[model samples]
Target: MSLFYLLAVILIASAIFTITQKSPVYSVVGLLVNFLALAALYFTLNAEFLGVIQIVIYSGAILMLFVFVIALLSSGVGPFRAGPNRLPRIAAPALLTTLVAFGFLIFGIAQRPFGPLPPHRPTSFLGNVGDPNVFGSVGDFGVALFTVQLLPFEVTAFILMVAVIGVVLIAGDAVPQPTLGRHRPQKRAAEREPILKAPAP
Candidate 1:
């Protein structure tokens, strides 16, 4: 088998393990491994920028968040109960739909005409910087991001900030209060007597 196919199988296996693992910590680690495998796949596809982003954003930031959340909630052990049931009620219909979708996708792929692969041209960034004449460069991406996609990026940042705030609020301790029917005792001079007093002649 080709290396690509081997990596794809490993990626799929890791993803399955990630979902099936009972422990949240192990699941997060599996997800991290899956992300790294995806990054490798992206590198194989010649998408270096996307691969780096996958490693930095998904593997680094998001996985760290998951780890932190697991550490905060877990007590170094699995839960007694595995929580509520997640099985779908209409399993038969869901399975039939999935099979039909897979069949249609395979039929579409089979119907595609095969042709000789086109030759690849080297991509250059420095040569096209600030050209305004050619496209497909780092400058073009920067321009698009700042001008066209600025609002979406801003919204995403706001959403992340709100999520962080929500997590913090949920993890914070509740306000302390006196026990039921209990009152604070008043302080008196006698009650406040010093433990050590100087002896007088």
Candidate 2:
């Protein structure tokens, strides 16, 4: 219980730091810590598969992507602040969203009956949907994803595929020349084309 509380504190603190930090790199690091703390909390709850997935998918893959984007955008080795925030407009929406989410979490926790969890054992996904042993385990998640949510899963995959293709198209060197901004080495006055104007008729 003490370990759980400790992990929970770290998770909340890191999560707060992730949002409040001025530096993008620091924010990413805080988020990584937050993810690890969440994984540890899952381990305490006996959800080993969830913990592994949290570490592998979120901390490993997602955080790596964030770091890569940070590196790509950063001019300096340390603390390159990110994008447009003329009035820090996102801060308002972010704060409101966090408050709503926190309210939901508090309400849910208050409504939930707290008690010690029962002992677990290995069981197949096929039987006993009511008291399934596969619950909280990776196999159950896989079964749910591949079975009940199959259509949504396929749609999500297709959307992701389209997104990747769009990124490739945007990043490739063969961008259309017409839309590009004109640069220096100005054309000589004689060489420049004159616009034809109709005399008032």
Candidate 3:
């Protein structure tokens, strides 16, 4: 229980830190910390598969992709220009959507108020629906992911792909055409030069 509370605090703090930072690199670091804390929270909930996914997929892969994109955009090859503020125009609609979602969340919580925690069960309990040995085992999670949550899973992948592309489109305009063209031939020639000069075996 205490551990859960600690993890929750860490999660909240890291989330706030992630959003409030001015620097994108700092924000990414904070988000990485948030992901770690959320994974710890999943483990405390006995969802090992979720915890692992949170770490491996979100932290290891997606977050690293974000870092890589930031690094690529920040490379001194071109000036980083700020894009138009799309958020200001969408603020009203976004606020309304958030409020509606919050209302629904509150209604659901009221419908099933959390009661006291049940007595601790033994570690050997095989009470999951699909898997008998563990509640959040990889097999059970895979079955649920494919059978029940496939749409959301695919949507998530699509969203990530779109986000990466959008980031590139937004910031990729900074690179001058002449610089890119010059670098490409140099890089290609450098690649071939080493091979061309190699002694025949």
> Candidate 1, residue 154: CA error in Å?
10
The lDDT per prediction is 0.74, 0.80, 0.80
lDDT by residue for model 2 over 142-197, one digit each (tens)? 67677777898899999999999999987675554563566657889999999899
Ranking by lDDT: 3, 2, 1
* Clash total of candidate 1: 0
Identify the leading candidate in terms of lDDT.
Answer: 3
Whose TM-score is greatest here? 3
Look at candidate 1 and tell me the lDDT of residue 46: 57
- Tell how far residue 43 is off in model 3, in angstroms: 1.2
Q: Show model 2 residue runs off by greater than 4 Å.
A: 76-84, 100-131, 170-201
Error of 1 at 195 (Å): 25
lDDT assessment of candidate 1: 0.74
* Candidate 3 lDDT: 0.80
Expressed as tens digits, the lDDT of each residue in 1-201 for candidate 3 is 799889889988999899789899999999999999999887876779889999999999999899888987888444567689888799899889989999999999889866665455324222344754455777777777777778888999999999999999987786555665454544556466554466779
